[model samples]
Target: MLALEELAAKYIQKTERVLTLLKSVNVSVSPDEKKVYAVVDEAKRYLEDAKYYYEKKKFETSLVSVAYCEGLLDSLRMLGYVEFTW
Candidate 1:
């Protein structure tokens, strides 16, 4: 449980950092703007879910949520829908 908590904390921090960085930059999408915005919105929702689970002491679930959020952001970056680094 301690290890899971530690891992979850690390991921949460990473996701938060990434989100902060994202907010500081202007993201221009090559594809449909509405679709890209929707994906970004979904990722933000996952981040919120992660935080909620973390506060509830569900470290494993929090980790999963954060990972999904990170994956979605990475996908957007890799697909050239957003400009940012991890």
Candidate 2:
């Protein structure tokens, strides 16, 4: 397993790419897709919290938060709520 320092370094290196990937994803939902939109909104909040933990040097928490964000994104993708190249 990677140590905290290595994990943090990797996170720093990959965060921008992940953020870009997230931003580049196109999410289109109609007014009736309120629940789906809410899930996306919660994922966005987790991403923000990940950034916060990363900035504070809470590497493990940041990793978990980012993982949660990604999990949410994956769920949306599987459910056809979002579209992306990756």
Candidate 3:
């Protein structure tokens, strides 16, 4: 339980940092701009959900949500849709 809590905290912090970095980034203007923004919006939503779950003491669910958010952000970066460092 302690380890889970610690891990969740770490991931939550990391996700928050990534979200902050994302805000300063501009998505390239291209045909996929709409789709890219949609994915970014979804990632933000997941981060919010993670925080909500964390506050509710649902560590596992919170971790999962944050992981999904991170994955989406990574995908965007990897695909060159947005530029940011993890």
Q: Show where candidate 3 strays beyond 4 Å.
A: 23-29
lDDT of 3 by residue, 1-86 (tens): 46767888888888888777775335554466778889989999999998899899899999999999999999878777777776
| lDDT tens digits, residue span 45-81, model 1 | 9999998998999999999999999999998888877
The residue ranges of model 2 lying beyond 4 angstroms of the native Cα positions read 1-32
Measured against the true structure, the TM-scores of the candidates, in listed sequence, are 0.85, 0.67, 0.85
Give the Cα error of residue 86 in candidate 1, in Å: 2.1
lDDT of 1: 0.83
Task: Please report, as a residue range, the 10-residue window in candidate 2 with the lowest summed lDDT.
Answer: 23-32
Model 2: colliding residue pairs: none
Model 2, span 10-37: residue lDDT tens: 6544644554665433445434477766
* Model 3 pairs whose backbones collide: none
Question: Worst lDDT window (10 residues) for model 3?
Answer: 23-32
2 versus 3: better TM-score goes to: 3
